[model samples]
Target: MDNYGGHIGQGRARDSQARRDAVTVEIGYALCSALFLAVVVFGVVAGPALAFELSDTVQGTLVASGATLGAVLFTVRVVSVLNRFAREGDSTDGDQPSQPGRTNPDS
Candidate 1:
């Protein structure tokens, strides 16, 4: 009905399916990267306690702090990554047509 004659595909369903697949891939990537980041952060924070003979209290504190910080970072990373994806998608939505199409019924 509009210019450029719809997307060059079998149908809207195909495009929708492709988009879903792309989103799934991106989500998987985000989660995997976030987990890796969390693990690394935890290891760095707790490394000294684990390596050297520290007091029980000190070790526990370090371990707990590490876990908390790692969890926070993991959450932030995932949210930020997904937000970025959403923002990028916003830009490409609804192709901008040079030639206007379809007049308003009321107007």
Candidate 2:
């Protein structure tokens, strides 16, 4: 059931294994993308150190800054992606039972 869009799932239950799989795949994508982003950012920031003949302190500082920035970007990417996924999967899409732990009396 694609309630992520108020009617997207089409009869799929919210707790189905397929839904779980989708969540898993989304998480994997977030992780991989974040890692790729972090590495690229780190390389862009720290690459100078690897290519230049700067003093030890400057090289160290650049490396540190690169690592820090990369980590920050990685966190941001993962969080933003997961948050988007969560917002899209909200039970407020109306797929959830009107009341839990009870049968619908009108059924």
Candidate 3:
């Protein structure tokens, strides 16, 4: 009887681990999607704008502004993806305790 109980407890703990893995996978997908969008937008919108604005701004300012915008957008995109992955992983890991080892002392 004790062995059976331990087996069941271990199974529950395994389930919790599987849930954590699933959350990590989901976060990876989300990060990929976000990066894809960033690439598309940067190519279609920012690329063209920067190209056209080349002649409008003073030569130095045009280069500076373009460089600044590019850096800012890239930073935002990278930080957002990293933050999402970290936050999701943390939340999922924190939310589940292995059912196997946990017990109420009062009980």
Candidate 4:
């Protein structure tokens, strides 16, 4: 029984660590994306005004890069928000007791 309890505890610890790892990865990705976007935008907007004028090719490249980055960040944010709402809806629905006479629309 003691050994079984120890195994259960270890399992819980592993599960907790997995969750932490997932969160860390998510944060890292978000930070890297934001940093990249900031750098690209700054280079395009500030670099030219500061006397470090970029060539036409470089300017166009920067503009395209910034647009792509902005789109990707926007999509990620929207998806995460939608996922959060979905998760919240699921939990709330689960918490509610079902009425005997009523049927779930989802079911």
Best by TM-score: 1
TM-scores vs. true structure, each candidate: 0.78, 0.72, 0.45, 0.43
Model 3 poorest ten-residue lDDT run: 1-10
Task: Give the per-residue lDDT of model 1 (tens digit) for 10-53.
Answer: 45566588889989998998999999999999999999999999
- For each candidate in the order shown, give its overall lDDT on alpha carbons: 0.84, 0.84, 0.61, 0.60
Model 3: how far residue 107 lies from native, Å? 26
Q: What is the lDDT of candidate 3?
A: 0.61
Positional deviation of residue 18's Cα in model 4 after best superposition, in angstroms:
0.7
Per-model RMSD to reference: 6.6, 8.3, 7.0, 10.0
Task: Give the lowest summed-lDDT range of ten residues in model 4.
Answer: 88-97
- Per-residue error for 73 in candidate 3, Å, reads 10
List, in order, the clash count of every candidate structure. 0, 4, 0, 0
Residue-level lDDT for 78 in candidate 4: 51
CA displacement after TM-score superposition, residue 40 of candidate 3 (Å)? 0.5
| Model 2 global lDDT (CA atoms, 0 to 1) | 0.84
Tens digits of per-residue lDDT for model 3 on 45-80? 446555675555565564555566655666676677
Q: Which residue pairs show collisions in model 2? A: 1-9, 1-12, 2-8, 2-9
TM-score of 1: 0.78
Q: List the residue pairs that clash in candidate 1.
A: none
